[model samples]
Target: MHFVVCLKQVPDTSEVRIDPITNTLMREGVPSIINPYDAHGLEEAIRLKEKVGGKVTIVSMGPPQAKEALKKAMTFGADRAILLSDRAFGGSDSLATAYILSSAIQKIQETDPIDLVFAGKEAIDGDTAQTGPGIAQRLDFPQLTYAIKIQELTETTVTVERKTESGRQIVQAQLPALITVEKELNDLRYASLPNMMKAAAYEPEVWDVKSLSFDTKKMGLKGSPTSVSRIFAPPGRSGGEIMDGTKDPAATVATVVQKLFQQNIIMVNPLAKGGKS
Candidate 1:
């Protein structure tokens, strides 16, 4: 079995800021890290590879500096890493990003047939959980999203437990499928010394727009239909009023009730049998 994990580099949300004039993310000085959800997905993929003898490949689409993210992923025991970077890929929305990533994955499939593709449930920066499903649609693979656990895996099929609004659900899908994983799926392992040394010296293969067979119309900003009009921080909330009741509990209760009635926040009916005035 071959596993492909789609990874991403994102700004640390804690330090994220929006440019006041440009209304865009201020990423210049912000620190970057592997998307937390994607890290969990990658950890699960590596765990599965360890359980069953197989190869794990990591793929990401970003600027040239994104190779840093791929190298970090390689420390987790992935066999191969690929980075898709090109000026033509700049300003791509989720739809365009999925197109580029899917194209690269197809190119990779030419040499090594892929059995399963994994991705994070959503990217924190965008919080749009559309890329994974989009890739599945383009690859024509069965998509299992919000996966919490891989219950079973065989040569021909896979059974997974997924998170739902009410509870959990178990679903089975054929091979050559895509799964979007949640962080609860697995805990990440610390990289070994040897793996860290290897990652420090590793150079991931970089592919540009010319490397893949892609429709030029669907490659970059031109292919993206969505655009953010503006982004701003929400106003801070005011503190709530605090009342002291330890000294006089009954007095406090009566005061609160009277205030509620005076403010028209409560009503009473004099005609009812159990009515209060």
Candidate 2:
């Protein structure tokens, strides 16, 4: 049950701003933290380790500063941490990012066969919710997204509850599966003094593009098929007339209803089914 948690360092929601020229996020100088959903994944991994007696490994792909995120995860009792950083790896889209992570996971598997891989549903900044599935696709592993709970795990199988728009679904997948977890999964535990001390002294294993025998064109911006042209706020709403309801409540209410009806803004739909109007 060697758990590998794929985490991302993201911009603080408050400090996130779009670059005018690049149409990309202005990530520089923004405070970073582990993706919230990934935190739940990390907690679940630690819990599994405690139950079954195994080690948890946390990994991330970002700029050098992302080591901060790895260190933070290490504080939460992860046995090892790794950071995949390289100048050539900058500006990677979800596909390219997943490719890099999948390669790292393969490298990790060479040393210790990975029983599971977990990731947040999506990064707050990207909000694509694509990387986890992408990684699972590349690795040829069964993927469970929006996982609420792991009902059971065994050497050959995994049963889990997944949250969906309709309701909870109980799903079973084969072993060596990848899961993209939701924030509602579980609450994180506080890091203890001993873990914190160890984490402060910990040095994350860093890997660059060359270290992975990566395809040059598929490494970074060159491999990314999508590009943001621009990002701007929606236009402000026009001022609306406020009905003078204070003068005569009944008259105002009647007038408003009459106006709405006249404008066909509150029409009764005769075709509505089940008498739902």
TM-scores for all candidates: the values are 0.92, 0.89
> How many clashing pairs in candidate 2?
0
Question: Per-residue error at 251 for model 2, in Å?
Answer: 4.0
For residues 44-145, what per-residue lDDT tens digits would candidate 1 score against the true structure?
899989998799999999999999999999998999999999999999999999999999999888999999999999999999999999999999999999
lDDT of 2 by residue, 1-277 (tens): 8999999988887788777777677777888888898899999999999998899998899989899898989888999998999999998999999999999999999989998899999988778999999999999999999999999989878788999999999999998999999878788999999999999999999999878878878868899998766787557898976888887999999888888888988986778996444
Candidate 2 pairs with clashing backbones: none
Q: Give the TM-score of candidate 1.
A: 0.92
lDDT of each: 0.93, 0.90
Best by TM-score: 1
User: For candidate 1, what is the lDDT?
Assistant: 0.93
